[model samples]
Target: MEIQKTPLKDCFILKPDVFRDDRGLFYETYNQKVFEKITGLKIDFVQDNQSVSSKGVLRGLHFQNGEMVQAKLVRVVKGKVLDIVVDIRKDSETFGRSFSIILDDVEHLQLFVPKGFAHGFITLSEQSIFSYKCDNYYDKASECGIIYNDATLALDWHLPKEEFIISAKDLELPSFEEAIS
Candidate 1:
């Protein structure tokens, strides 16, 4: 696997070495030893989560606050998506900045999202399967998010605003400024 650093500290884009044959292709997703050696950080992912959504579906700009913050390894399982991560760590240099990448089955790319960032994604294919490995268990009380269209962040989802299918809960999330405040 090749670890590509993002502008945000501790975040990375992992490109696995794929092996192909007449039948299909194979690649090692995660190996704790290799991961630790490459990233220099050891994370134990306790929970694995998966979701399926149709094109235009948008989820997140979300994170867990305080002690419940989670580090995640996220990827596209079967389709394409516009994955985004925002550095929300107040003490970090890249705080408030956002990064975006196109993750799809074709590239087999994964993003390593450290505990201090908020993450979200929008499905770009007719359907998509998204999966993630989180280092911590989830807590409802610790859940927090910035609205997808926060003016301060001005994220480009790639798709027009009218094409997005945002949840009522997500649509009601706080703005980037309001969230930090």
Candidate 2:
């Protein structure tokens, strides 16, 4: 796998070597050795989560606070999505900065979002199957989110504002300023 670091610290885009044949293809999606070599951080993913969403569906801008903060390894299995991560660590140099990438089954690429960042995605195809590994388990009380379309963040989701569809909870999420205040 080729791990490419994004502008945001600790965020990575991994391109796996896919071996194709007349039947299908295979690739080593995750290997601890390679991961450590690339990121210099050792992670032991304790939980795996999967979700299915239709086009126009947007999931998050979510993260956990306190000790439950998580690092995620995310990929798309059946379709495509616009995955995004925002650095929220108050002490980090790149705080408030965000990164976005296109993850698709055909590319077999994965995204690694370290703890202290907010993670989210928007399905780009009719249907998308998303999977991820988290270093920590879910902690509802510690979970928090920023509005996906927060003006200060100024994210260009590649979709028009009127066309972007999101859940009621996400829509009700506070802006970055509001949340921080």
Candidate 3:
């Protein structure tokens, strides 16, 4: 596995070594020892989650606060997506800044989104299978998210704003300023 750092602190892009044969292809998505050695992140993911969405579907900008915080390792399995992450830690040097990357089935790349950040993705293919591993079990009371299109951030999702299909639940999320404050 190769660990690539992003501008946001504690975030990374993990590329795995793939072996292709006449039968098929194979790669190790996560190796505990190697993960700790390369990223210096001592974490044990307790729950695995998957979401399937169609083109233009936007799911997040979501995170858990305080004691329910979660760190996620995410990847795309069946299609393509533009994954975005924003640092929301009040004390983080890169607070409020965002990072974006293309995660696709072909490349088999993964993103490590540590606690103190909000994460979201937009599908660029006909359909996408997005999966993630979370270090902490979810807590309803602590769940929260900032609006995906927070004006302060001005994120360029590479898709037309008019084409977006967001949930009413997500549309009502607070702005980044409201989240941090």
Each model's total of backbone clashes: 0, 0, 0
TM-score list, all predictions: 0.98, 0.96, 0.98
Report the backbone clash tally of model 2: 0
**What are the lDDT scores of the predictions, listed in order?**
0.95, 0.91, 0.93
Q: Looking at candidate 1, what is the lDDT of residue 131?
A: 96
Cand. 3 Cα-lDDT: 0.93
Per-residue lDDT for 1-181 in model 3, tens only? 8989999999999999989999989999988898899888898999999999999999889999998999999999899999999999989999989999999999999999999999999999999999999999999899899898899999888889887989999999999999888
Error of 1 at 81 (Å): 0.2
Off by over 4 Å in 1: none
- In terms of lDDT, which candidate is strongest? 1
Could you list the CA RMSD of all candidates, in the order they appear? 0.7, 1.0, 0.8
Give the per-residue lDDT digits (tens) of candidate 2, residues 95-127: 999999999999999999999998899988989
- Please give the range of 10 consecutive residues that has the lowest summed lDDT in model 3: 156-165
lDDT of 1 by residue, 101-158 (tens): 9999999999999998999999999999999999999999999999999989999999
Clashing pairs in 2: none
Ranking by TM-score: 1, 3, 2
